[model samples]
Target: MIAWRAGAAYPPAGPFVPVAGGRLATLQAGPERNARGTVVLIHGASANAADPMEGVGRLLAARGFRVIAFDRPGHGWSDRLGAATPAAQADRIAEALGSLDPGPVIVLGHSWGGAAALALALDHPERVSGLVLVAPVALPFPQRVALPWYWRLAAQPPVAWLLSRTLGPPLALYYLRGASAQAFRPQPPSEGYLERARVPLAVRPGALLSNVEDLIGLPAALERQSPRYGSLSVPVLIVSGDADPLVRIEAQAEPLAKRIPGARLLRLPGLGHMVPWVAGDRLAEAVADFLPEAASTR
Candidate 1:
């Protein structure tokens, strides 16, 4: 009941599709057939498919591109499959893509989802014709950052299960508004973002456990994955805000672009971490410009 209340606080925006590992929930817009191309959206930690669906997915759909956003494994209405690593998440998402779409699709990932996007490109290159990574956490922290005490405690399996049923949802709800507000630092969050994004789904016991595990396990995954960026052959477009305090541009996007041969980097002067939400118009324009090239390659 607690898991139901916390994760299902808001109903899923779309349907579920069976895939390897488990099922995935997805929100799609645009024509199912005869569209210019398909765009697959992978959201980050503490977010569901609605985060990008409400931001850029619908906009791209209206522009005649098929836009589909997935609730990453263990997030929103999707099942948790012990998918803490990007490669594992990438495999699950790739399986769904293979079953659903007939051709390669443009994959766009935001924040933590960026790592999964890169993983997909590296492991399942045939599934991705191009990549759009926004404020992505592509590299390990330059310094050994200490984990929060609560996070460390919660990392214990039994403790996480206990907290999830008891205090996790309530505590997560208490800070939801503030965290949402902080994501758009320097720029206010879009109107009705909290309602539209369905962020409360992150509070569920299973989702919380998956999210914590993802965070704790990400550095090691990046260490193993970052070395392969130079080998990527797909068209890569990385968009980041110069003022993003959460994922510094210097550490992630800038260097990532340097590593990938022929990758394009767009640095928005005054933007923050929530680029897709606040800069949808600009983002759409960039995607529109790049689509022809991305499509041509497929």
Candidate 2:
């Protein structure tokens, strides 16, 4: 695992705690003495909490929020504890929340992280004050579509090894650009935009492999978890980009909005899956607006 930069501005805010036979790396920002509420952010597949949530953390902290982000097991600075199941990840999150000072907490997750967040709310509802899902990949089983053939071919063992060593980096870059182009509306994405967008793909080691596993496993996980959606009574916000290719807005977000009673859905007409980074400020504002009520004590 890559060692965290020593004396880095964003230092580890707490001790690494053992969870599910692995250690989770955690960081916190905002008031150290007294906090109003806490927001726990979980990043998408192949990316650690820091890479995806750093901008959001800064924005939330500026708005007087205690923001906590963690590298889930097997990613970034956290211990590799094999493939982490979504249920186990939620349990670890619950444990992390317990260790924090008492306060309301809003759990926010992106993509694969959203699946874990939903699982957490279902398994430990009392720990969460509300929920926010961004470009969430959670959907019912037997995915509406099949994996692209290239993705399937890449999953093969020997071929995967070769691709990882020889063409992975460039291919990863190409895919990022291509995906961003398709997702963005009106204007074409620039090199600078692609650079920031690709950061999540670049930072994680063995990202491709992990992403493949996530795509394969998530459908079943969502199928199992979908039935319990009605049981979630917490205020929920689901954000999705109408143009998002990675997750179909109509197929996933539309049904989810209708299913979760009183769930608020924000559909950005031309936005893409990279909305968190591409429009971080707007996303932050949405969260800020939604949080005030959820933050208030019931």
Candidate 3:
């Protein structure tokens, strides 16, 4: 296998936190004591922590809040701990947070990262003071969406191993622009986001396999976990674009806002899945509403 270093593209914006799986890579900003609560950012499939949250992280940092972003297991500079379920990843992150000692935090999760953030709150409510979910897939759809035929093929060990080593990187590279455009329909991404975010890191042999397994396992995991959302004690803010081409607003954000007793939902008009890039500081401004001190200032 090829060894992938962290700083080549994305840069090491924070220290690596040692964990059971591997040294978890993180990007952090702000030590502004006058700021609001600490913020933890978790990114989704095919992305490292800095991918979706970079702009927002900077904005929050400028506002004086400590912002921390982690490259989840098996992606970016982080090593593959195992094939982890959301809850399992949550446990590992909890330990990582213990090492940081940032105190109770505001957690922001995008897409698949949203599930793990929810799991963190479910398993350890005292650790999360508030939550922000952007274009999340937090609820179990009444019916399972169909997976591609290739997903079935990859489910098998022999086929998966062959594909990961042979065709994965090429395929991911070939489809990069098209997929990003589709996901961001109605709004374009910032120029060169793919290169800036180091999209190639995700398509590396082992990362590809882990992402596939995570996608395949999501339905079952949400089936087991969706019921626990209402039991979470933290205040929540769920944001989605009405035009998001990836996760359905009705299927995820709307229903989740209703399900979680007091969770606030914001449906952005004419926006798409890449809201962090497309909307930028506006999203950060809305996120500030979740923190008590930030909200008071707002």
Question: When superposed on Cα atoms, how far off is each prediction in RMSD?
Answer: 1.5, 4.2, 2.8
Model 2: which residue pairs collide? none
Q: What are the per-residue Cα lDDT tens digits for candidate 2 across 1-298?
A: 2212212323444557666666777766777556667788888765666645554776787877788887775564566566556766788778766766445588889878888888988898888888889888767745446567777777777876677556764566557556556644433554455333224333233655656666666777777888899988888999998888777788778888888988999998887776676677888888889877676533
lDDT, candidate 1, 1-298, per-residue tens: 6557645668876878898667999998998888988999999888999999999888898888988899999898888876889999999999888778648989999999999999999999999999999999988773246367778788788998888779888888889899999988979889999888888778777788888888888888999999999999999999999999888899899999999999999999989999889999899888888898788778
Candidate 3 positional error at 126, Å:
1.9
TM-score: which is higher, 1 or 2? 1
- TM-score list, all predictions: 0.96, 0.80, 0.92
- lDDT tens digits, residue span 139-242, model 3: 77633354677787786878877888888767876787887777678877678787766766777777788788778788888999999888876788888999
**Could you tell me the TM-score of candidate 1?**
0.96
* Highest-lDDT candidate: 1
Candidate 1 local lDDT, residue 108: 94
Clashes of each: 0, 0, 0
Please list all clashing residue pairs in model 3, or write none if there are none. Answer: none
